[model samples]
Target: MNAASPASPLLEVRGLRMHFPVSEGLLGRKVGDVKAVDGIDFTVRRGETLGLVGESGCGKTTTGRCVLRLEKPTAGQIIFDGVDIASLGGKQLQALRQRIQVIFQDPYSSLNPRMTIGQIIAEPMFVHGIEPNATKRMERVHELLTICGLNAGFADRYPHEMSGGQRQRVGIARALAMNPEFIVCDEPVSALDVSIQAQVVNLLEDLREKFGLTYLFIAHDLSVVRHLCQRVAVMYLGHIVEMADSDTLFDNPQHPYTRALLAAVPVPDPDVEQGREFRPVKGEVPSPMNPPSGCVFHPRCPMAVDRCSKEAPQPREIAPGHMVACSEVKITG
Candidate 1:
């Protein structure tokens, strides 16, 4: 679908679906499709972080990759800066890619250890034809290194020579080198030490403020999302169960799954946090290849009613900017 205006959403994902074929035989015969990101919709405002939170295999990462056009979606549209990129051809996609970037999770594996930090950061500039002068590239690379809190001299060192935090900083520098307006941060700090995670996240926050970057921060850690994202979208079995401003979702979660997720967040207060009143999400997440009928989460929802097992709830706006898709959802938080 071609977007109607050149002034439309900076990033608008509607009914995005990415289903991977599942093969069961030793010969790898196709048996089913893993309904990863199924019919999910959300928007990223020009300069805010929209945290995509969910359990493992809930397709948060798949959604991010689809937005980046790294993986082609099975359905729906990805409208970015007034262009629907979902159906863009390879040549067209390449041209539009310069404005979007990604900061991957594992800094160690994300960067080529064989390459020097300066080269890693300079490569983006070279690829985009932003700064072809070797001297200018060097100058820009050093400047970015400084901004990411690494010394200019450290640019000659390979990724393996630096700590996880430092490698992540290099990754951030590479992402910023192209002056991208939108970024998909796929669990950027999940693999780092807790102390290092803070530094990387803080750097990302500062960069966002300084460069006016929009981010789709996908992570399983809700606490990190609460701190970084302006709004939060919770996914379950390839569908968004709830979405609201960060504070609203954390303080007064509506859907049963969301409430369970928040309750599971470890609070510092051991006494109150350990109480029996809090309920851990029950049962295992259903297999995506064989998801339950009606509500995908009905089997595990404590408040699931008879209707929940037979009919899927439509996502509806309960508050000004909050939407949830659970019929038995009650906001008691």
Candidate 2:
């Protein structure tokens, strides 16, 4: 695939919000909204991997879902290749699916038990009418299996017959089968064994380079994100609190939450790990249905001041391509 201009973004999300209505009683009267993703914005440059990292309920997955158009946003824009897809449906959305694909977190649940691996991978092609010929589809499946580091023979086996790592490789093959330009990897390796995680991550990295694919990689594992993504975005309570190049954000995190998250990552060396100051974030994440006023993180922020409780902070660029959303943090050139 030919790479798009390096400066042009393949995907751009602006003020994306997914607020699920909370209801009560059989009447199902809406009482409140669970703000899963609230007004977060970011861009994925063509052929670059952008990592979205946060706690389990911090809305990282929600953001990715909104981008995939699986959940309609309450209000915002999801631009894919310069077209707004947030409200698209029918044939248009179906057409968009051909260019964008997702590799889910759980390999066990994502694959079909009844379908053979060949059928599972070929299903997308069939739905999109990519390969109409039965022989050609099977041949394409074998090629994809080999590309994903699996033997072509595995195509005849069922999902129950493969190991977890092998199952995940099958999932990767399925995503690639679409010939997608962009992919959403929602913690693709999080369910695998630690040893297997590295292999899967490496495979994803290799595949991206080979195909010049763009990725919106949603993961909680900072180490994995650092290994695979060129840029990283840190989310807190439905908002992106910080973003920067992977190296810059990992080494010099500006937001309080970003700093705490990095601190929580365990160092492999005992001497370094033990010597490093480890302070867990003070409190549990607040409920998104009734998030705290002003900055949602103020309640848990150690550096929070009185103003942080009364005034929300918008993301401000402190340095080139490094944004931080904290009132207390000083901007440095």
Candidate 3:
């Protein structure tokens, strides 16, 4: 479902900006802002999956962290279920955390080596004061392990003893402990093997349907994003260049950057691949700290114009629900 629906957004972000100050000199005087996530906005609907995709350092992870209060936003309004979380402080922020959970990129790193799987899963319940009895917490831990396809006996084992896929299951079990309606999947399968990736993705889909959860699925891989996300947003240099339903964006990409990204994906058939008039993208990505004036992507864009160099294009809905931020979105015939 689209975020604009009056039923209300599970999570809504408006004019979100996360800038890191570049302090220089002996006195640590502010020189300039990194502009890591300079003024981008979007939303997550209740029980829906929204994928945030970009090349590395495009600020996808930063945006997710800002929304979850893992990192404080430099400026923006973050409204969660009608409550403005960005303006909240102290006890309120802690209370808000129970509703939002995060699954990190590396499962091995995320799971504590010292803690057993059961203890790891039950940690959130203990923090939230959800279970008073030790016995009850253990039971809940067993239930979670089972839900994520792990045997109850496996809970006694440490993270190191488990395979990459198993460790990830434990991670998922931990996230589910709080019964959170929303979760930030911060590239949950990026580090796993190819065989493991599909299983993890399928597990996520199963969990979403079973639990009625919403997700901000952050990833750099387009193939992964298309498989898991209902709607997709493509970010570039701290801004969303294009957003649309998965079918529309993948089948008929509007933005030049998106097209270039897709072109890099390998075609299944060699004959068709050989026939393709490939226009491989060139040039190194410009530094975000000292980004170009007009469009951030104009420097690397193949079909750049003089106007593109000087004029920044706002994201506009040229089609019914598809939005693009490019002066020219002319795909070859």
Candidate 4:
């Protein structure tokens, strides 16, 4: 794992919310909101990867999308490099896109099947008017392909012509084409095969070190998150239940949800796997459109009390750099 940077935050999300309006009828009248991302805050220090891990529909992807500005947020601020990008528009937003890039989850659909690998990687540079010379653009594309662990010859090939792993490498190359400072990797290796996942994850780690890149990595694979992220933020029903360094969160999880999540990850040792009891988190995830009162995870939280059903738990710093949103948890030295 990359060391956590002590540098100032490259990105800060404060009370960020993305509430999709639930509509009905031909007129599309709004009934309620699908609270994808409720009020939540976190930061990605320069050159550090912050993992956002949660169950499906917990708003991990939505939070990343809000950062990329793919979806306009319903509330809060996305402060990047000291500028609040939540309200940026026109040329300003367009310029910001160059600094922040995304590597999508699906390799098959994220790329243009019609374009060659070279064209795919070059498209971003072309749109942004980087490497204006045609020959230089092609050279840059070849260089990026090589940097992403693909053969330079692969540039002539189309998306359909390459394997799943190669396609994802192309996707990474495309993101790097913009020379971005921060990248939102939305499950970038989740779709690939197990062996391929390792290769891609290693590639990402190498690229981060080589280019000094910061990432907001969103994934459901706690194992991968533990390996790749320096710090982790656990989300549940649109709220961050826990946030801590990877080692601390995995080894000494305080929140009930976080403990359950770590418990769910299969241990590699056969003896331990057989001996350990598996206790999955009880209850299905609640609907975000109408979340329960008080703590969102109270229904499933083992440590929950009567007050948990009435008062929402604000995130409290229990130790230096470790935050938990549970009334039952105590501060530690």
Q: Which one is best on TM-score? A: 2
- Off-target runs (Cα >4 Å) in candidate 2 are 1-4
Worst 10 residues of 2 by lDDT: 1-10
Model 4 worst lDDT window (10 residues): 1-10
Give a tens-digit lDDT track for model 2, residues 244-287: 99999999999999998899889899999989888898879999
Better of 2 and 3 by lDDT: 2
| Candidate 3 per-residue C-alpha lDDT over 207-264 given as tens digits, one digit per residue, 9 for 90 to 100 | 9999988999999888999989988999999999999888888999989899999998
lDDT of each: 0.89, 0.94, 0.88, 0.94
TM-score, cand. 4 vs. native: 0.97
Q: Residue 62 deviation, candidate 2, in Å?
A: 1.0
TM-score of each: 0.94, 0.98, 0.94, 0.97
- Weakest lDDT window of 10 consecutive positions for candidate 3: 1-10
Q: What's the C-alpha lDDT at position 225 in model 4?
A: 96
Error at 195, model 3, angstroms: 0.7
User: What are the per-residue Cα lDDT tens digits for candidate 1 across 70-132?
Assistant: 999999999887779998877788777788999999998999978999999999789878898
Backbone collisions counted per model: 0, 0, 0, 0
Tens-digit lDDT string for candidate 4 (207-300): 9999999999999999999999999999999999999999999999999999988898888899999998998888899999999999999888
Worst 10 residues of 1 by lDDT: 1-10
